[model samples]
Target: MKIGELARRTGLSASRIRFYEASGLIEARRLGNGYRDYPEDAVQRLEVITCGQQAGFSLEEMRALTLEPTGGANRHERLLASLKGKVVEIEAMQARLAQSRTHLLALIAGIEGKPVDISCEENAQRLLARLRENDEPHSQAT
Candidate 1:
């Protein structure tokens, strides 16, 4: 099929397909008429590329997984490791976000619980001390 057909089938633009080809993520053969021809399997390859990108894989990482040789063994093992590593990174990010959220909620509660009798300067000092005490944002979410 041609670039247009591939783009329609993949829901990607022709330029994106060309960019992938240029970036060595996919390949196309040139016909005698100066047109690019693609095999049926190219559709599957493009799907995998897009899906990998959606799953947080960079173009370079996608290129490595799809292009690099893994010694003819169960190539899937390398892919599996990469997927697991990404999951770990995502989990760590989730933990950090959870802690940050807890810190924000704590600050909000402290502000709302301020004693009306206290002067502004004293209230600020109290908040400041509270902030200093919880500076790490390490509070665990229940």
Candidate 2:
């Protein structure tokens, strides 16, 4: 079918389909009239590409999975290994985000606990001091 039909069937824009083609994710044949002709299997391939993208697979990774020769034996194992690695990376990112949240909450608490009796400039100075203290490296008592 034509690119327009393929776009409608895949629920993707024609430009996106064209991008996938240019990215080497999909293939199309040029007819005698210079119009692109796509095979029926292209629809399923596009679906797989979409699913991979949703799973956080980069275009390079997707290309590796979809285009590499796997010897037809360990494809599932490879995919599982890749997924496990991604989980570990995501967990590390979550840990950093949690630390960031804790630090932000502490800063907010410090700001809110400032003495109301002090001038605004004094309060600001105290906050700056608190931030500087937090930025300093404390020596652990061994």
Candidate 3:
């Protein structure tokens, strides 16, 4: 199939297909007339690339996920392992984000609870103290 047909079938632009080729995530052959020719299985490969990207895989990671390497079992194992690893990474990121959010909310509370008559410099000092306290070993929120 030509790039146009591939793009139509995959719902991707021609430039995107060309970019995948440039990134080494997909391959195309130059025909006698110099137009890029894709194999029938290119549709499946492009779908895998898109799916992997949607799941937060980098183009480098998608290359591994989409490549048709020799030894079918190795390919299957690699895919499964990569998926599990990605899940773990996402969980860790979620936890860190949650912790940071909690710390920010606490800081907001401290600032809001300050006395209305206090000078700005006094409020700043109070916030610095709160920060130092939060940064202690047992109280560290993030």
Candidate 4:
């Protein structure tokens, strides 16, 4: 099939398909008439690339997984290691996000809990003081 047909089949733009080819993610053969010809399996390959991208895999990472020929024995082990590493990274990010949410909630509570009689300027100053205090390192009790 032609590049246009492949693009239509993959629901990707022609330029994106060409870019993938340029990025070494997929290949096309040139016909004598200078038209690009793609194998039927290219559709499946494009789907894999799309899925990998949606799963947060970088182009280079996708290329490694899809294009690189791993010896039959270690392929499973390598894939497992990569997936485990991604899980760990995602967990660490989740931890940081949770901490951030906690901190923001605390700040919101502090702002809302301020006495009604206090002026906005006074509340701002109090919030600044609280932020600065949080920034300071606390001494650990032995």
**What TM-score would every model get versus the actual structure?**
0.77, 0.79, 0.84, 0.80
In candidate 1, stretches whose alpha carbon ends up further than 4 angstroms from where it belongs are 69-71, 113-128, 136-142
Which ten contiguous residues of candidate 1 have the minimum total lDDT? 133-142
Please provide, for model 4 over 12-52, each residue's C-alpha lDDT reduced to its tens digit, 9 standing for 90 to 100: 99999999999988899999999999999899989988987
lDDT of 1 by residue, 11-35 (tens): 9999999999999888899999999
- Strongest candidate by TM-score: 3
Q: Which consecutive 10 residues in model 2 have the weakest lDDT in total?
A: 133-142
lDDT of 2 by residue, 38-135 (tens): 99989988998899888778888888788766466588888778788778978998999997897788768867887878986788788778777776
> Residue 25 deviation, candidate 4, in Å?
0.9
Model 2 TM-score is: 0.79
**Candidate 3: which stretches are off by over 4 Å?**
68-71, 139-142
User: 131 in model 1: Cα distance from truth in Å?
Assistant: 3.4
Clashes of 3: 0
**What is the C-alpha RMSD, rounded to one decimal, of candidate 4?**
2.5
Q: Write the per-residue lDDT of candidate 3 for residues 29-98, one digit (tens) a residue.
A: 9999999999998999899889888998999888766766656888889888999999999999999999
> What's model 1's overall lDDT?
0.89
lDDT of each: 0.89, 0.86, 0.88, 0.86
| Position 83, candidate 3: lDDT | 96
**What's the C-alpha lDDT at position 26 in model 3?**
78
Alpha-carbon shift of residue 109 in model 2 (angstroms): 2.4
